[model samples]
Target: MTPLYQVSDSPAVVSKKYFSRRELMPSQNSSVWQIQSGSVRTMTYLDDGTIVTLGIWGAGDIVGSALSTIEPHIIECLSAVEAVALPLDRQNKMVEALAAHVEQAEELMVIRSYRTVDSMLLKLLGWLAKRFGRTVDNGQLIDLRLTNQDVAEILCSTRVTVSRVLTQFEDQGIIQRLPLHRIVLCNQETLRRAG
Candidate 1:
């Protein structure tokens, strides 16, 4: 594993690396990048070239190709990101990260299993809201800057379908779309009723 940082004769200092949105993060053999801010999605391609999103990670989450056994693993920034490389030597930390990955995978699997795309997308929005949203005056606000294409990639659906559903959601007063791809879920009660 190549070291990401340079060693000097002075005190040790870990530097933060910045990544622009849609940029691919470097893979290391013996280390992982811990996100200091923003979010990223780890993914891989199938035999037929279908893209499979492994997981979405945010602040304080660790990501690296070394942690995955899948071939052609990649981590792509979902927003402007700041991260630091950390040696992958801590067993407990790795365990937690792996567990989170598995749990989220299962959650997404269930979300995609819904009979209708509308149901699936609604569930996905609720999950994203719970995971990455912040409290606003009206409800939870999801400001991940994810485009319809990005949501389609995560849901394993088509971008047109996702866009239509989002428009429908807005019309039904289930959510409010803001600039920069932000979404504000009306309320937990509305979500439960929609489901």
Candidate 2:
């Protein structure tokens, strides 16, 4: 992964900070976090106390304690993370920073609106491939250590279901699991083929 310090123009990085795995970033008010390296997950509670994951943000992605104006959510570090806190304490930088990701936000909404779970997952794989995967001899390697539970949260499915679906994909030769939590898209063409 590229070091965050290598970036030449992120003035918001003055408050560069580090967080341990599973540590929660402040989530009480509206604030934007600029991820330098590593990843973070944001989640909210349902009326029945169920956890609904908002998103898994990686490098270059921006997140907030409560991104939605309607609900309060928690932002936690999924892995050891280095980021810059753009505390919305005084400036309208929050609005400007968030404006940078308008297109990413729209893409996520489209992916989430898919009617079928498999379709949604497939589209997500394609999206991730474009966002984070790299071409290799065997296939496209997604450079994120995403687990089934993490995927389930993003897809609003159970870990059991995510595991089953991913296994099924491997069985069909669409994807392969590498050591650790990495995934290789063995058949990108097949994955992108409309179902």
Estimate the TM-score of every prediction.
0.52, 0.49
Residue 166, model 1, lDDT: 96
Model 1 RMSD, rounded to 1 decimal: 13.6
The lDDT of each candidate is 0.80, 0.71
lDDT per residue, candidate 2, 143-195, as tens digits?
89899999888888889988888899899888888878888877648546521
Clashing pairs in 2: none
lDDT of 1 by residue, 2-40 (tens): 333233333244557999999999998667888999999
In Å, residue 187's CA in model 1 sits off its true spot by 1.0
Best by lDDT: 1
Task: RMSD for all candidates, in order, please.
Answer: 13.6, 13.5
Off by over 4 Å in 1: 1-91, 193-195
lDDT of 2 at 114: 64
